[model samples]
Target chain A: MPEKPDRNAIEVRGVRKVFGTGENAVAALATVSVSIRENEFFTLLGPSGCGKTTLLRLIAGFDYPSAGEILLYGDDIAPQPPFRRPVNTVFQSYALFPHMTVAENIGFGLEMLNKPKAEVKARVAEMLRLVRMEQLANRRTSQISGGQQQRVALARALAPQPKVLLLDEPLSALDYKLRKDMQIELKRLQGETGITFIFVTHDQEEALTMSDRIAVMSAGRILQVGAPRDIYDRPADRFVADFIGESNFLKGDVTGTDGGRATVKLSSGTEIRASLPEGFSPSGSVTVVVRPEHAQLAAADGGAALQGTVENVVYLGTDTHFHLRLDDGVPFIVRRQNARGGADSFAAGSRAGVVIGGDAAQVLRD
Target chain B: MASAEEIARAADRKDIRDRWLLSAPALIIILVAATGPLLIVLVYSFLTSAAYGGVEWKFSPEAWVSVFLERDIFDDTLSLADANITIFWRSIKLALMTTVVTLALGFPTAYFMATRSEKTRDLWLFLITIPFWTNLLIRTFAVLQIIRNEGIINTLLMKAGIISAPIQILFTDTAILIGMAYVYLPLMVLPIYASMEKLDFRLVEAGYDLYASRWQVLRRIILPLVKPGVIAGSILVFIPAIGAYVTPSILGGGKNMMISNFIELQFGQAHNWPLGSALAITVMVIVMIALLVYVRNTGAASGERRG
Candidate 1:
C-alpha cells in the first residue's frame, strides 16, 4: 500500500448521514468530501438545516457517518467516540455547566484526564488569561453576560489543547457589534493557537471574515470550496455567488470564447465580455455575475452600457445603493459612494447607464 | 362626575365585592367542614381527660408532659403507650426504607422517560401512572393473590423445584414494603419525572464532551441537576408511607403495626379518644421534624450550588 498524504488535519471522504428508516428516512448529508488543511480556519457556510452542523458533528466524532470515513491526523477515527477524539466543540448554546464556576468549567477537561490539581490550576489560569476572563473565574455561568459566557465557552473548549476546535455557530448568539468584534478576535485567536478550526455558520459575512477557506454548502451538498478572495471574486456557480454577497445576475447566452474569456449576449440584446469560469460549457444559457460595487453608473449617451431608470436611491451612511429598472422591467442594483460622481443624488425615473467592465464579471454555467 | 382615580378605586371595590360574592358559599363550607374539625382536634389535644371518661374543659400540659417527660408513660401497656412508640418507630423505618427503594428504582425510570422522544415518553409515563388510576385496595389484594400458596409465583417456584413449599410472603414486613412501594410508586415517579424533565441535558453532554466518563457524567452532572426531584419525590413517598393505614393493616397482619394502625385501633376497638388524639399529635410532630430536616438540607444544597 502507498503512504497517505499528510497535509490534512481532517480528511472526510464520501460521508453520508441519513436520519430515520424506510419511507421516513431523510438524507441530511450526502457523500460530502473535503480535506481540511492543518492549522487553517475553515468554515462551512449554508442556510439553516443545510447539514453544516451535521458535518461538524461528524468531524467532532459526536456522530458517525452512515457511509465513508473521517480521518484525523492521518488516522481513521470513524469508530472513535467524541470523548476519545482529540477535538472539542463550542456548542451553539455554549452548553456551559450551570452548576460549575468558570474556573471549574475551564478545568473540567484537564481533571477528566486525572491531571494533578496544580497543573489543572495552572492551565486553567493560562486559558482564562488567554480569553481575558481571569477576573471572572469564580463567577457562576448564569452570573455573567452573554459575551462573557462566550469567552468562558472558548476557554473551556480551548483549555484541552485539542488538535481541532469545532465551533458550531459560536458567534450567532452575540449582538451585532459584539459578533463583529468576535470575528476579528476569533481570527487572531486561531492564529495565536495554531489549531485547525472548523467553524459552521449560516452567516455568510462571518464565514468570509474569519475563514482562510470556506466550503459553501446547500441542501447537504458542498457547492464550492475556495479562499475568501477566490470565492468572492470567482464563484463557481450562481448559488455560491448569490449566497456570499450581493450580486447582479443578468441572464445571457455565450456567443464566443477566446483563451479564457467569453462574449455573452444579454437578454436586453447587449453584448458583454467576461472571464469563463472553469469547466464552462457554452452550449446552454448562462448568467453573468457582477458584484454590486463593480457596476458603475454613467450617462445614457456613453457607449457599451445597458439603459435603465433609477427606481430608488438608498443612502446607507458610508455608501449609497441605487435600485435601477431597465426598459424591459429587469431590476438591477448598483452600489455607489460619494467618491463615484455620476449618481450621488439621482432622482427616481431618471435615465442612466449601468456599465460593468469585462474583468469585473464572471460567466457562470450554473 | 367622578375623577379617574375615584372611578378606578370604585371599580376595584366592585371587582373585589363580586369575587367575594362568588366565593362566599365555598368559604363558609371550608370554615365549617375543614377548619371546624382541625379546631376540635386542637381543643381536644389541649384538654385533660376526666377519670371516668368525658373530656375536661380545663387546659392542661399533662398530655404534652407525658409525651416528652415521664418516660414510664411511654412504657405504659394498658394505654397503648408501648405499642404507640413501637408503631411510630416502625412506621418511620418503613417510610424511610420505602422512600429509599422508590428513589433507587424510580429515578432511572423517570430519567429514561424524560429523555425519550415525545411519543414514547408519553407512553412510558402513561404506563407508570396506569396502576394509580386502578383501585388501590384491588391492587394490594392483587399482590396477595400473587404471593399466596396457590399463586403464580408459588406454582412457578414449585414447578422449577426451587422450593418444596410456598414462601410465606403475605402478612409480613416485606409484603407491606412491596404493597406500599407499589401503591406510592407513581407518586414517587411523577415529581422526579417533572424535575428530570426540566433538567438541561446539555449539561450532561457538556460533561461528556469535557472527557468525563458515563459514570462521572451521571454523578457530577445528572445527579446534582435532578436533586430537587429526588428530594421532592422522597418527601412525597415518605410522608404518605409513614401515615399509611390500609396497606400496613392488610399486609402486616397485626404483627407489623404502624402509627396509623395504632391510631385507628384507639378510635375503633379501644374507644379511647384522648389517647388517640395524643398519638395523632405525636405522629404530626414527627412528620414536621422530618420535613424541617428535609427543607434545611435542600436549602443548604442549593446554597452550595449558588456558592
Candidate 2:
C-alpha cells in the first residue's frame, strides 16, 4: 500500500446511510467503502433505485452518512455541509439559475468563494471557452437550449476549481444524439481539468464510454468494480454479467477444474470449456454465460457440437442473429457477421449445431 | 360557384365577428359601469365649487389650484397648501410603511407555506385567506379590540404585571399601520407564495453545491427569482392603503386624518364638491403610478424568464 503510485483523492470508509427512523428506515447505502484515485473518472452505475444517486449525494455533502467516514485527501468531510466541502455537483436537472446570464451563472461559485471580481471574470471567460459557449455568455440560461444550459451548469460547478466534481446523471436529460456527444465532451473535460470526477449513472453504455473504472451497484451495494474492458470481459458474478450486456445463461455441471478455468457439461451432454471468476471453485452445478456474438451456427451433420434447432433469423445490417433452441429446450442465440449470401443462410425450422468460441464462455458464480 | 377556400375564409371572418358580438355585452358593462363614475369625477374636478356643496356650471381651475396651493386670508397671496400637503404626504408614508410591514411578515410566511407538502400547503393558504371571508370593517374592528388601550393586548399586559396602566395606542399612526397591514397581509402572502411555490428548489441545492451559504443563496437566488411577486404584492397593498378609509377612520381617529379623510371633509363638512373630486383624482394618480412601476418591473423579469 505504501508503494502505490497514485494517491487516493477520496476514500469512503465503511459508510452507511439509512433514511428515516425505526421500522420504516431504509438503508440507502449499507457499509459501502471505495477509494477513488486522483484525476480518475470513476462511475457508480446501476438501475433506478439502486442507491447510486444516494452515494453521490453523500459524497457531495448534501447528506451525511449514518455511520462512517468520508475522507477527502485524508481528511474527514462527513460532518461538513455542501458549501463547506471542496466538492461541487452538476445536478440532474442542470439547475441553471434562470435569472442570470450564462456568464453570471458560471461566475457564481467563484464569487461565493470571495474571489476578486477581475479573477472571476477571467475564470468565467475561461470556463465559457472550455465549454465552447462563449457566444451565448450574455444570454440568460432560460434563453439557451437545454444542451447549452448543461454546459453552463458544468462551467459553474468547475469555476471554483473543486477538488472533486460529482455529476448526478447529468446526461440523462439530453436527447440521444446530444447525450452521445456530451459523453465524449465530459470525458474530454475530465482529462483537461485533471479533477477527480465521481459520476452517478444508470446507463451502462455511458459508464463504459466515459469511466476510467466503474462500480456496478445493486440494492445499495457495490457488486464489482473494474475497468470497462475487465467488467465486460470478466464479470465477477451472474448479476454483473447479466446487467452489463446481453448474455445467454445455460445450466451446467462442472466436469473438471483448472486454474481460473473450468470444463462445464451442459444439459445437452455437450462439454464446454469456460473461464472461472477469480478464486472461484465450481462444484456440481453452475451457470455458463456466453455472448451471442461469441457463438455461431454450424451444419447439424453429426459434428462434435451442441445440437439445436433454428427457431428464427434476424438480419441486422452488419450481422445476422440466429435464434436457436438447444435439444434440452434452453433457448440460445448466435450472431454471425453478415457477408454475401450470409443473411438468409439459416432459415427458421432448420436443425443447426451451436459452437461457443474458446475463452468466450464464462462459468459465472451465482 | 365559389371555391371551398373562399367559403372557409368567409366563415372564419364571420366566426371572429360572432365571437366579438357574443362578448359585447360584458365589454359594454365593464366600460360603462367602471369608467362612468371616473368620467363624472374628472368633469366635476374642473367645475366651480358651489357654496351649497355641489359643483357650479361655470368652469374653474380653483379646485385644482387648491389641491397644491392656497391664498392667505390677510395678504391675499398664494402660498403652498401646508395642510393638504401634510395629509397627502402622511397618506403616502403610511401606505409605504404598511407595504414594508406586510412584506417583512409575509415573505417568511410565504416561504414556509411554499416549503410544506402540497397537501399541507393548501391548508396554510386557506388559513392565510381566512381574513378575507370576514368583512373588512369587521376585521378592522377585530384589530381594534386587540390593540385598544382597554382591549385584549393591554388587559393581558396588565394582568401579567408587565404594565402598570393601559397605554393609549388606538388613535395613533402605529395603530392605523397595524390595521392596514393586518387587512392587506393576505394580498402580500398569496402572490409571494405563488412565486415561491413555482421556484425549483433544486436551484437552492445548486446554490449550496456551488459554495453559497444559506444567506447568500437567499439573497442572490431566492430573492431575485421571487421579486415579481414582491412587486405585485406591494402594489396590491399600497393601492388600497393609500385610499384606506375604514381602518384609518377607526384606528387613526380624528387626529391622524389621511388623504381619504381630507377628501371626505371637502364633501361632508367643508362642502367643496370640486375639491373632493380633485383629491379623489390625486389618489387615483398615485395608484396609477404604483401600477406602472409594477408593470415595468414584472415585464422585465418575465421577459428574462421567457427569453
Best by lDDT: 2
B-chain TM-score of model 2: 0.91
- lDDT for position A114 in model 1: 89
- lDDT per prediction? 0.86, 0.91
lDDT of 2 by residue, B89-205 (tens): 989999999999999999999999999999999999999988889999999999999999889999999999999999889999999999999999999999999999999999998
lDDT of 2 at A285: 96
TM-score of chain B of each: 0.84, 0.91
Candidate 2 C-alpha lDDT tens digits along A30-74: 999999998889999998988999999998888889999999999
Q: How is the predicted docking of candidate 2 categorized under the CAPRI scheme? A: medium
Using DockQ, give the best candidate's number: 1
Q: How far is candidate 1 from the true structure (C-alpha RMSD, Å)?
A: 4.6
Worst 10 residues of 1 chain A by lDDT: A1-10
